[model samples]
Every structure is written in structure tokens, then in C-alpha cells.
Target: MGELIAVYLTVHTPRYCTYETAFAGKLAHPDFRAVRDGLVEQGRQLAGVQPDAIVINSCHLVATFPTVVDGTPRHRGILTAQEAPELIHGVEYDFPGDYELASAIIDRGRAAGHVCTLAADVHYPLDYGTVMPLVCYLDRTQRIPVVPVSVTLANDLEECFTWGQYVVRAVRERRRRAAFVASGSVSHKLVRGPERWPSPEDQELDHRFARMLADGEYEKLWAWLPEYAETVEAEMGGRHLAMMLGAILESGRRFAAALHAYGPSSGSGNYVISLS
Candidate 1:
């Protein structure tokens, strides 16, 4: 049997790292629009893979309690615009991969540190973190089922790691092949806070982080957290990235990350990582 391939990632507002002003002012940047367009394009390519599934793993869709909604396990679902209205309100959203992946992540999350719960009917719109990328990448006509695994609020590292193992194992055990996607962004300081300035050492730190992810060194990735938070923007996706990477490697597959872009367009740290 061929090894299972998963694409784990995160998603954020296009200018997530750049937000440092009032909502209106922050929304005024042309670069934000361009980056937003670029992210969606990335998703389009992901959808093209036509794998057994595409999972959207993120903390944005979390409930008060952690939950995993397996759309396909119970029923077939779609990623139509209306289904993920958070991306574009009032539009029915549907995708083929969303629900299947959601179910898997839910089961994985429960094993990792969670209790399953549904979104309380069909009205629970997917947050933009999911909608934006899925909608952007997927053609309106080509449906991909989606499964959303919402992270928990607890800070238990062991729970997170265990969940990572479950995610990796679940995908590996599937009789069919699949590709997973983690939908999140790197450090984002777009929101205003006293700690919202770009550090001089951001580029150097970004390089180190990108390299660690490329090398598949989970221990090294976790080890850098304390120093990274102090030296660079504190908003980087260390935990999110770590768990996703751990999940992928747990399945015994090596990964290579392409540093698509690692420059400071926004004041906060920003970069795009593609793992293969």
C-alpha cells in the first residue's frame, strides 16, 4: 500500500500579520487583498489533488468544548459557500473533503483530548479560517468533502501530542489514500496590543523556524518556543505547527517544506509554508 500523504496547515485573514490599526484602516491595504487572493489560489491547487480527503484543522472553529464533526462518517456533506458562510455570510458553502476530514479529526481529537459535539444543526457556519482557503482553492463546481477538527482550550501538551498521534494514525489506517491540510497562519500581530511591533530579528528567526519545519524536527520546533516568543513576534503558530507536523510524521512520512514567501509586508511576522 502507498503511504498516506497528509497536508496539514492553518489559515488566517489575508493580512493577519499586518493588522495594527483600527478595523477600517487595517482593511484599507491593497496588499491584504493581494495576499488574500494568493491564499485562495493555494487552496485551489490543494483541491486539485483529488485525494481521498482534505482536512481543515484549526482552533478557530472550536466550541466551548473541543469537538470533531465527521460529515462523511454519518452523512455526505459539501463545502458550498452557504455551508461555510463565515467566509461569505448567507451563501451556502459545500466542499467534498470538509466533512470526512472533520469526522476523522473529531475522532482523533477525542482520543487526543476531547468530547465530540455537533455544531447544533446545519446553521453553524464555518469560520473564515476555513471558508476563505477552501473556497479560494476549490472551484465552485468541484466539490470536496471537509472535516474540521477544532482544537481545545486546554494547554495540556500531552493531550495535544496524543491527539497528533491519533490524527496521523487515523489517516494512515484509512484503506484509501488521503491528503490533509492544516489551515492556519504564522505569527499574526495584525490585532492591536502593546506587544505588536516587528522585531529586528524576525527574518533570521523566520529562517530558523522554516528550516526546522522542513527538517521534520518536532523536538527542535518545540524547544525554540520560549526563545522564539521572546526574540520575535509572539504570535507565531508554534503549537499549531508543532501538532500538525507531529501528526504528519507520526504516520512515518517525511516532509519537505517550500518557503513560498518570508518577507515583512505587514509589521508582524508573516510567511507561507507549503509541505510536501
Candidate 2:
């Protein structure tokens, strides 16, 4: 059967799509440089796995009511991020979609009584949350098949975790080597400055939170999630993190690969973390 190769947690801020285009070359921070270095390192680690396919759950790909899994045979889109069109515009992307894997995930989830659906619509658009990770992680010379997962508003944290359990079953049934990525931030209280970091309180808490995950302190992480999400204003209600945690839980709570980087992007806490 298929085996999960790795789990990655990273940020996909639009401004990082390009080197000089962001902030009109004005915004700069030591954290910015640190994160850039971290991404390069993260990319190197991902490349080593040679994953047959990638399953990504992006915070931006919010589903209507059911969990959405892309089943299209081909994925091609131009993304001009709605949040910041000027800085992240006209970015073209083309990648193959894993119809089989997507189907298996849906079937397994449906059988388990979860609201999971396939998104096979032609040319389904992908948000920056998904694309930016590809840009940062995937090597374009060889276009690996992508199975994009969505965080649905309908499911609470527990349901999302169950959905992830089904995802693991589906991946194993499909018999393909895969990678799962959680693409979003921790402390996401957006303010006016791109280079600005979150408050000292948020910064301290975000570090602790990420450390909890890396340390495989699931009990403590869960215990602190609600307050932490509210206090730091986690992106998308921390659904991406919940799903990632679920996926990891299904993977037997394996130690996090290594948390190599943590930084701030427009007041949000981002990290380049690996868990396998």
C-alpha cells in the first residue's frame, strides 16, 4: 500500500511569490531573510523524498460545506491573489491532478459518513495558499501530481481530524508514495505593515505552539488550541493546523521532521516545519 513520505507545515504569504516584487522592494526584515533561507532548506528536504504525489490542505481553499478534493485530470490556473492583487498577479500554474487518489479519499470519507466531495470542474482555480507552496516546494522541471484538499467550514476540529484519518486510508488504498502539506500561518492578526511582526505576546505564544507540535506534545497542543487560536487570530480558524495535526495523528504521531524556521509575515507567524 501507499505510505506517507512526509508532512510539511509552511506559510504562503503572497509577497514571497517573488523576491523583489513584494513591498516594492521597500519592506525588509531579518525574519524575512531567515524565512527565505528556511524555505530553501525546506525545498531541499522535500526534493529528497521524491514523492509520487502531494496532498495539500490550504487554508485559502475554503470549501462551501463539504470537504473538497480536486479530482480534475489537469490543473491549470492564473492566480492574482484577491488579498493582494498588485503584489501577487498574473502568476500562471499548471500541474497534473491525481484523480485516482482524490477518488479514493472521497470514497473512504463518504463511506465513513463524512461530507467529502470531488472537485473535477475543468480548470479549477487554486488559491495562493496552494500555489505558493508549490512554488516554494515543488521542482517545476518535473511536475508532480497534486491532490488539493480543502478545509470546510462545516466541520469542526474533530471532524476535520476524522477526515484526515480517512485521507490516510485513501492514500494507503491507492498505493502511492505521498506528501501532505499544511499551508498557512499561526498568528495572523494582519496589520498595515508587511515587514512588521506580531505583538510580543503573539510571538511568544506562536513559538510555543509550533514547538509543541515539533515536540509531539499533542495533548498540550490540543489543550491550548482554542485559546491560542483566538489570542493569536490563527488563519482560517486554525483548520489547516487541525487537519495537519489529524494527518499526523493518523501517521502515528510521528515526531515532527524538524522545525527549522519561524518568522512573521504581515503580522502572521509562519514556519518552515517538517513532520514525518
Candidate 3:
């Protein structure tokens, strides 16, 4: 069977901490509720498909190295509950060809000055962005293997895309049944600083991107640049989208929908998206 992959859904905020007063307070600025609801629905759908594994490409988990995808060590049990104490949790899941792909991507990115690594340990918490959507899609009863693909944001688009293509090639070669989820948002315009806020023009720009993603129009996706920068303010997240897109499309699968699209009109512009 081919690799089963799902891209990351943007849960930019700490919604998992149901009782975090600080997190709850900021929820109004960027509708954490919207992101949470969308994530829950996505989780339900993923459980229904029951793929061999899931691939979550997220920047939150990006580190200096490649991780084994799951946060568990080989022989420990990693707990997901918020109250669960951190410990030497067992390696919960492992994806086929993930290590190969991560290693190659890291090497390529490093050559281009983008430092990255692969994690096989079960100690660190698989950051929330990776876990939240996971909670939404995966069945509690069935703990499938997970492959986490992360990238450092310290490089140019060409560099990131080069590394991302390597990631896609490795996953496609592994031939596991998987779905790729590219988890991120368009702009971080929501912060209180001078960052540009989302104007009606920005909304127009997001709509155009949503349309491109829906159509699987790679030519248009690749051509996005001067135009995108004009609307997107900063281009940090677009690379994440492009790299994840490359990985998913490389699997020879066609995307059916932009799935869910909602950016918190706040400057943060965090949005959630799912592709099938």
C-alpha cells in the first residue's frame, strides 16, 4: 500500500489547554474556537479513512534535526492528555521511509543554509500543531504510526522548496498509505505590533490562494511571488504551504478541496486547511 499521509491543520494557538487562562484570554484576538471546531471535524474524517499512517508537515515542530515523527521513544508510551506528566513515553508511531526522507531533506537544506534535523526520540512532546489536528483525525482506538516533517524558517523559498521536494520524494518512494497535511497560515498580521493587518485586499489575496489550492494548480502555485508578497505581508508561511503541497502532490494524488478555509481577520491570519 502507498504511504497514508495527512497534512497539518493550522492550530496556531494553544487550544488544547482547555483551562489555560492566558491562552483563553487571547482566544478573542484570533478565534481559537474556529480553529478548534475545524480541527475536531478533521480528526473525525481521518479516523474514518484509517490510513496506514499520517504525515504532518508543520513549522512549530521544526528543529535543528529530523524527528522520528511520533514523540514517543521506541519502548515508552507517550501520553497525549494535557495533564499527563512528561516522561519517557514509548515511541507510538513510525512512518515508512520517513527517516530517509528527513535525512535527505536536512542534508539538502543544510547545504542551502537551512539547518534542520530528524527526531526519533519519544521524549519531547510532539508540538500541539502536530497533535491537535491529529487528535481530530485519528481514532483513539487505533494508534497508527505518524511521521512528522518539520522545517526551519530561516531560509529562502527556493531553499525550503528544494528541501521539501526531497521530503516528498522520500515519502513517495516509501510507498506507504498516507495523507499529507501542510499545517500553517497565510500571515501573522494579528500580533499587536506594526505587522500589517488583514485588509479587504488581504482577504482577496487569501481567496485567490484558496482557489489555487482547490484546483491543484501547481503552475499557479509556483508562480506566486511578487503578487503574493503584495498581499501576504510576510512570506514565512507560504513556504510551509508550498513545501507541504510539493510533498502531497508528489504522491501522485489529486486534492479534492481547499477543504476548510477561515483566516481570523486578525493580523495573525492563522487558517485551517485539509486536502483529500
- Candidate achieving the largest TM-score: 2
Ranking by lDDT: 2, 3, 1
Relative to the true structure, how large is the alpha-carbon lDDT of every model? Answer: 0.52, 0.79, 0.53
Alpha carbon lDDT of residue 60, candidate 2?
92
lDDT of 1 by residue, 235-259 (tens): 4234455456556657676776655
> Each candidate's TM vs. the true structure?
0.71, 0.92, 0.70
> What is the RMSD of candidate 1?
5.9
Tens digits of per-residue lDDT for model 3 on 1-276?
A: 445355544544443322231223434335455555565566666665666655666656665433223323231334344423231123253223345444544555456555455565645456545554453334344366556666555555555556556566655565656666666667545654323346777767776776777787755776684358445763355656766656655655666663554645336555566666
Better of 1 and 3 by lDDT: 3
Question: By summed lDDT, which 10 consecutive residues of candidate 1 come out lowest?
Answer: 16-25
lDDT of 1 at 144: 51
Evaluate model 1: give its lDDT. 0.52
lDDT of 2 by residue, 27-56 (tens): 356558767667667777888878888899
Query: RMSD in angstroms, all models?
Result: 5.9, 2.4, 6.1
Candidate 3 global Cα RMSD:
6.1
Give the TM-score (vs. native) of candidate 3: 0.70
